[model samples]
Target chain A: MTTLCCGGCSWPIPVESWNREEGVRCPVCGEKIVALVFPAIARARSGAQPEGLVSETEASCFYHPGSRAVVPCDECGRFLCSLCEIEIDGRRLCPKCFENSLASNRLEAAETQRTMYDTIALALATFPLLLFWPAIIGAPAALYTVVRRWRAPLSILPRTRIRFYLAALFAAAELAGAGFILRAILRLPRVQ
Target chain B: MAKNKSIYRKLTPRRRGIGGFSQLWLASDHILLVRSSRFVEQYRRFALADIQAIVVTPLADHTPWQLAALGASIVWTLVFLVVDSTAGKIFFGATGAIAIGFSMADIALGRRCRCYLHTAVTRELLTPVSRLRSARAFLERIRPAIEAAQGTLSFDQIAAIAPAVTATPADAPPEVPQAPGYLPEALFGLFLVNAVFVLLMQRFPNELDNVLPTTFFGEFVILIFALARRGVRDPRRLVYALMVIALLFMSWDAVGLARSFTHYMGSVMEQSRRGRPAPPSLTGWVAFEHAPAVLAAGWRMVAGVAGLVAAWFERPVKTA
Candidate 1:
């Protein structure tokens, strides 16, 4: 069962993976995290807590302060609010952890791979040129495109990796064909 | 993306290489295994599943048999059929079998396969201090029985020697792994091979009732050793009878050309190899016959190295 969201990585965790009796771990950072098993009834109550009835922390975000908590990361047992929320593969995340995951990912991945958005944009800009050339620049560029596509892990999710390669192929081909025509008129051998 | 990080924080009350004495600690629900003192109040192995974490400590690498089993096992199924719990039982119970550990198998190889199964096994292990003592006692108790079992075809010994001839795939199994390392890996190999055969025979195109020869025999042998050691527990003659039954079952295959083709292939490879071919007298030895046993014996020591390598290069496949 999807037990709760982790306070650190903000990923959904199964009950078996967690320890409510003792602090469990943040699956991402491998840090000890308290798993507060809040009662459903208390969670259902949505008004300002009575003074002295709840401590300041009880009212504040368990993971982050200065930000009121509307909910907690189900896995790590950290409190979170809308601002701190991030969604990954259908799970919610705190802003800090979400950014951390992204940052860590960036650090983990080499500079060759930018961001998902960048890859997609690069692929998009390069598409539409495939028709112009089939060899020379086009052939080489298309090969790069395919390699890039292959490098990006393929999945059901809309991963732009494949598209980027295709786009590169198209762009390279278009540029090559255009250059071929210019070369032919400009007293240069046409590159096949 | 937002995984629970707490799982990775510390060891539970039990360390990864927990030996025999650690059993009481690990088996008991009250006991927790943590990695470090700083993590005492934080997270423990008990909650490892919550964060999809794996518990690995140094001494645990001493438990290498399963790791080698994993690498050798890739020839067939994507999932290494054998898991830690079953592998543990075999290693702890058996006298000296060890195998490789594939972190890929532990963590679902490439990464996409993060089902609940992975963490369950990696989460806890009884301590070695307890294990080594139990091992000594077990050997002494079973010495006579094991010696007897060692007679005849001596399945365990033959199994150990098989990889020497098996010709590991492109990533061939390492050469003559150090002691304790090879045993677990082979057992793990058996586990993985067992899992694969189960999938192939049961989950694939066949009917569920069809029992796999590998699992059927592997389990029976385990029982035989157990019963032989006990002698007085349950009737062990039944196990002996089952051995005959298994011998026949393992030999049951297609007739004529199909059998001849397989037999010939085995014979062709058997000649002039590092390992002696399965004895012609032994009718039941198939190619996969020693898959598990050999793998268990070969990689147990280096399973840690395999795991670390896997961790470095392994990208989990994202399963929907």
Candidate 2:
């Protein structure tokens, strides 16, 4: 199923030989296969570095990668890749830090779940209401969700800030709409 | 295979809604599994396992369209209650608006998500291949609840724990009957119809605008209400979801409004001391230029959504 691509045409080299891990070799170009899905992907077939592509070796884990782990610890944010990874409490941790961190607390997961639930609930609420009453209520709910997640200790932030972004944007729209309505209603002349 | 914790962090996050907003990711397992926006946003690792099912039901099941319509009705109802001039016309306009918005919502429901759900769930069912009957039976196990939500189980006499009401998004409208939806060109047909409808209903002549308190075209958006409940194959859940969103938005608006009034009053008193009479309303104190159109649009969206939810109760269910 795999075919090496040609460097000159950028098409797959004939289906006789292709490796996604190694990338396609260009028969006409005589360069290392760097066309589509090829080997030596770290270095181009021409052996030139592309502008944005970075070699995996050069990229350092925020923590120590030499400690023999593939994954970063979920708590301390250490770069403990697969082999060095371990379970601490219920979450994944680096082997060296797992038992030690286990003694600290288990509040992280519960708090993360709580905030996530609140945010999804509120974002869903914000969209339907931004036209209804969002100008007033949307901002506060969005803010509360943001503050709850952002203010938490770095060790335990909700893994994502997506809800806050969604809620905040829609809440702003809702509030603006409400303001517009209030303005229009009051401007009409009274019967007396 | 051990779970790769590092895979969670060393990740690039992006979203694509190729078909009705379902997201997918390049997982470490080298497969693209469809995911929830919230879940993908939260856990960097795409947990392909969580997807239980994917069903490609057409416009027959969406829910947001109804909520949008409901939003419109509520807005008009408030306006009629306050404006005090054209009661019958306003009521007629508002009720019609509610209906159209909800119907649109219903149509939008089956537009996309059912297919996504069916695809995702069936993929899981196929991993073992032998689990097809089990999977179908499992879904059937929840069939009554799903049917009750969809309002398909009439003879069972068992009612949904949730009562049917206006525009609750969780109520599962009955499934769209199985029809082969292949007309690759049908999308073009829909686009043409949509353009004509918008022109005829929404962008009518000013004479049309003059006759109605609001433009007749204003009623067109009610279509969105039916779209929101597509995920709910049952009536109860659809209603419950709609109720939650509608109530949440209304209460939120009510409280904020009271505060804005006070803010307006304080600004007025400050302006009045210079010998000008205070206007009875905030229009003078605040801005009125774009309020009505904006408010109407917002209402229209919510009303359409709410109506779609309400209409799910009227859907026909399969008798299996």
Candidate 3:
């Protein structure tokens, strides 16, 4: 069952009080927010164990030798009892395989933290340019970063490497300016 | 042994850390918010049965800030290239990076608004999870436990009894529509636009005269009218609104001061390195840059103090 909570405070909104579609003021915070309710099916319990294990009479679970095996894990092909069996995206997986799949993010729906290198590179290349002085060092740093992270994983959402290109271009410009300044400084004594 | 194990499992709240390093524990009967700093540890508990509502506020749009940061970085990078001072370039570069970093964080971060757990009597804050997906998942994990402890088939029983009206889509989840953002967000956006315009004008010495009018009007518009809008009808809301506006102005000015002050100090240091005595006349710049910030901070503090006083006076009405 889906629980609807007050938007102003996390208290469970009384189901009876909520209409199918309407705004309601949270009694606790007095903030108005809309609540929409929908139907849902219950998920079968993952940790349920078998009633009994029969030796020799039935194919037993790999983890629970006594409990009858319900299905074979799609990935590892291990026989699993009701407790060990996990169905994900229409594929039956044993507990260990399911966990591994989650860790590896083989399943697209798995939640995983990803490092955004493009943003970091852009920030590194751009911020130091603001003061005019840091860019001498920052430009090179940014260039190096762009090159290093060119193949790095980006945000989960689709993003282009336009930031990377921009960062590289700015860094190159900073480097060119720095070179020009160094040449002018060197030529000052020659003119003297 | 079995009883002890069951008691342990039921009593222990499912613990998880949210985006801001804040921890939340969902127990069999209550939710616990745990916040710890160097000096203090604070824990607040809201009983599951007592939780009257949960609010998910929508995140304010930050696209403008991201665009602004990106534009500023590119412009400053070119400016830094033209400027001969190495120290200045590096300083501005770092500052620009930080600005962009903040903007990016704001843009990339989850969109979940502040989540509050409200009881029958008082409202409590939960460590706001940034992503709606994460927040919803957290709620799903805790809902069954809360319902079981309450001993009422308040939520789940409805699914069983309520007809699965085929016309109603099977996968549709209930959602809370976003409320309008805080008024101060619009005010702050306006104030920042005005401030940026004035600062850009002040970049040139001859354009300095235009700065005063712009700054004056901007301040009056943001500070004066913000306070004026509340009017006299609801004194409590007026005080609250004033308090919020003051705090926003204070923080905004403080960040500006910090950035400007760093740049100013860097220029001074660069001059000293060139063996030239720092010009005393530049002292005017110090006051010019910082006076408003100091004033805003003072006003914010005063408003905060006054808010406490107002709250004291408001006790009777609140209870009533």
Candidate 4:
């Protein structure tokens, strides 16, 4: 039997093992306790072949040609041994492919940071309305923003194009209003 | 399921006095306290991991204040009846009924003592184990469970582990329970009552000569009791200090009530001798003898403001 520690406080729990269904309380911190059950890490030496390497007639590891190849890399199609093969999401990959895929995000394992143009466009078109003086400058800036990022990728989740449309409409309205104001200002001296 | 059943255990409550209306159920991860009274049935859960401390304080006895309020209200009703004022009768009767109702609530809802499950963010009342003996028993049953749940780690070790896990907001640990807003509620009620009493005193001085002190003293006792209850429920230094200040103010007012009344009567007699028409009905008398009623009002304002500040500091739990 292995000793169970609290998830909250890491206090040594006296219980034999955690029950999967419900959680317990940490006597020390009083946090709700749930056990994280994982297999013990193996202490065996790395790259130690269980059996003798295959001869020239049989398949050999791409990285270690003297060792036998167990699986092929899913991405690069290179032969890999037990030590050289990295398993992720049920797919085996060679060390170089694994390292490269993670670094370059070729595997699409995670999403990178992206600019949210729709948000920027919306902010440009609306925030300037607070200080009426900036509306003249903001109208053109908002218009330019929408046009530049029109074809850019949106958020990872599903969303409609309503925000883009709204931004464009507001920007157009501001520009028209600015024109109307300019025309009215020019006519004011003649009327007086 | 069998393993689940084995993990789930029942906590032995220290006290069992809700006429068998309260129960404690312990699952692998949480302890649930189910309390059912005639008016309400409340279920409270304490996560095993989040519990920082468990404490039981001595049971509260609200009898002295409850009886005081009851007596004063009854007296006020009699005085109103003797005066044959229909509005006065109704008003005083309502006050008396309210006082009785609160007393009854105190009897039904008030526990002998307070037992609480403490965490960093919240202090939860354990109604079942309110008695000293029962709370002890409850502690006995839950101690091993908590120790077992936690295994072994010091407070510092837990603190060190918290930052490592907060890299992803999605993976962030659950928010701790918030403190219940009972203290604020109590403080607000006390302040409101004081305000109303002050307004009434300003409007009707002669009629409320006896009434004001009686009701003020009565309400003071009740509010003090409420403050004491809150202190026991959640021990905080600020709350304790506020309670002490309120007590001192109340004592000062109680002692001065007799002298103020005597002075008021003396002034009224002197005005009669001089053949003055009498004080204006438009506004209550501001000065009662040599001592100004403004002094008493000032004291009340101080206390009310203090209560408000205390209430402000006592934050309630957020519910989503």
Question: Each model's DockQ?
Answer: 0.02, 0.02, 0.04, 0.01
Instruction: Kindly give the number of clashing pairs for every candidate.
Output: 107, 125, 31, 28
- Reference-based lDDT, each prediction: 0.36, 0.38, 0.57, 0.59
TM-score (chain A only) of candidate 1: 0.31
Instruction: Report how far off residue B126 is in candidate 4 (Å).
Output: 27
lDDT of 2 by residue, B238-311 (tens): 43444445445444443544455557777787779887888764343321113433443354355445545453
Number of the top lDDT candidate: 4
Model 2 steric clash total:
125
Worst 10 residues of 4 chain B by lDDT: B1-10
Interface RMSD of each: 23.0, 23.3, 16.2, 19.1
Candidate 4 C-alpha error for residue B68, in Å: 25
lDDT of 1 by residue, A59-140 (tens): 5664456556776664465767555554444466666656666666532211112234324434344433334333445445
lDDT of 3: 0.57
Residue B111 in candidate 1, Cα distance off native in Å: 13
TM-score of chain A of each: 0.31, 0.34, 0.73, 0.63
TM-score of chain B of each: 0.18, 0.23, 0.44, 0.35
| A1-192 per-residue lDDT for model 3 (tens digits) | 334555544555544444323455554545544443322213221346585765688888999887889889999999988988876666999989888988886753343355556666677777988888988888888889899888765433334678788888888888999999999988786653
Q: Can you tell me the CAPRI class of model 3?
A: incorrect
- Residue A62's C-alpha lDDT in candidate 1? 49
lDDT tens digits, residue span B3-46, model 3: 11211122222333432234566645556555543113344666
lDDT score for candidate 4 against the true structure: 0.59
